[model samples]
Target: MRIYFLSRRKLILLLMFLITIGGLLTINLLTQTIPSLVRTPGTYYMAKTQEKVVALTFDDGPDPVDTPDILNILKEKDVRATFFVLGKAAESNPALLKRLVKEGHEIGNHGFTHDYQQRKLVAEMNQTDQVVFNSTGNHTYFYRPPGGLVSKTQMEATKRNGHVVALWSVDSKDWRNPGVKQIIDNVMKNVFPGAIILMHDGGYQRTQTVKSLEPILNALKASGYRFVTLSELRTLDSDLK
Candidate 1:
C-alpha cells in the first residue's frame, strides 16, 4: 500500500481553487434559471451596434399621474422612449395610450395583469395587443414580461403572439426607491451603445425614477449617446444582421 499527503499550504490552495470553481458553477446555474440580461445569447437584451445609440424603456405604465409626468420629461428632452404598458391600465386610460402614439413614443405590451404564466401570458398579450391597437392604432411588437420573468413556454407563447421579448441591458434598480443619485449612478455606470435601460413609471411611487431620468439623460447625451425607442433599436439590429 502507498500513502501520499498534500502539504498544508498546497492543500489550502487546492481547497480555495475548488471553492472558487464551485461558486462560479452555482452562479452560472442561478443565472440560467432567471431571466437574463446581457449574458443570455438568445434573449433580446439589446442591439449590437456601434452607432452610439440606446433604448430607454419604461415598464408597468400608462399611470394617469406618473405616466404623464414621464411623458412630459421625455417630450422636453426631445427623446422617444418605449413604454411597456399593462392592458388593464391602458383600457382604463385609453387616452394616455393615444398620447404615447401622438408623442411618437412606442408602446409595448407588459401583459394584462402582469402575469407570466405561459397560457395566461398568451391571453394577456393578445388582449393587450388588441387594446393598444384599438386605442392607438399601433401594434405592439415587443413584449416585456412582468418582472422580466419568462419561461421557455412563455417565450414560445410570446413568439406566437408575434412579439419579441425585450429585456434590458441596464436596470436602474429604481424600484427599490433607491436615492435619486444612486439611480443616476447605476444607469450612468452601465450606459453603453445599444443598451436598453430599464425604469418604471406606474408600479408605485415613481418620483425617484422620474427625478433620476433628467440627469441620466443629460449625462448620457453629453457623453454623445443618442436615445431611440426599442423598435428603432431593432431596426439597427436588423440592419446589422
Candidate 2:
C-alpha cells in the first residue's frame, strides 16, 4: 500500500480553485432565479391578475419566412399577440411591420441591432421605435431588452423613454429547436394567468417554433385561457392595482 498527501501549498491552491468555481455557479443560479422573484417598477416580467388571460410575445421577428407563418396561425386562431421586433429586420421588411399593425398585433421595440450594450440601450430603443413608426406610423410603448438582459441604468433609461421593459415568465425554449412537442410542453407546463409567454419568430431557423404555435394556442384555448397583447395584459394588470 502507498499513501500520499498533498503539500500545504498544493492543498491551498486546490481549495481556492474549488471556491472560485462554487462562487461562479452560485452567481449563475442567482442570475436565472432572481428575475422570477423580483419585479421592479417599470419592468414587467408578468402581470398580476387572475382573469384567465395571458400575453403572447414574440421576439427577434419580422422574418420574411417564419413570421408570416406564425401570423397566419394567430389569424386562424383569432388570437392577437405582441411582436418584439428588431429594427434591422423591420427595416428590411417594412411591409411585414405594416401587416402586423394592420392585423391588430402590437409591436414592441427589441432594439435596433439586438445587441446587448447597456450604454447604448437608449439609442438602440430609439432606432427601433423610429423604424416601427416609419412602417406603421405608430410608436411602441413596450421595450424588451435583447436576451432579457438589462442593467439598472438601462431600465431607468427605458422608463425615461416612455417604454415599459417587457420580460417573460414562461419561455417556450423553442429557440433551441427542441422539437415541436417539447416546445408546446414547455409553455403549457409553466403558463399561468397573467403570464407573459416568450417565443422567438426570428434569429435562426425557427421552423419548430412556428410548428409549435398552433398546438400551444389550441391547448391554451382549451384550458379556457384567453390570449392578449402585452398592452392589453398591462391594462388588465393595472385594473388590479
> Which candidate number would show the highest lDDT if scored against the true structure?
2
> How do the residues 56-172 of candidate 2 rate in per-residue lDDT, one tens digit apiece?
999998999999999999999999999999999999999999999999999999998888665578888899999999889999999988877777888888899999888888988
Residue-level lDDT of model 1, residues 43-127, one tens digit each, is: 6888888888999999888899899999999999999999999998899999999999999999988999876454588788889
The lDDT of model 1 is 0.86
Deviation in angstroms for 221 in model 1?
0.5
* Each candidate structure's count of clashing pairs: 0, 0
For each candidate, give its TM-score against the true structure: 0.83, 0.88
Q: Who wins the TM-score comparison?
A: 2
Give all candidate RMSDs, comma-separated.
5.4, 3.5
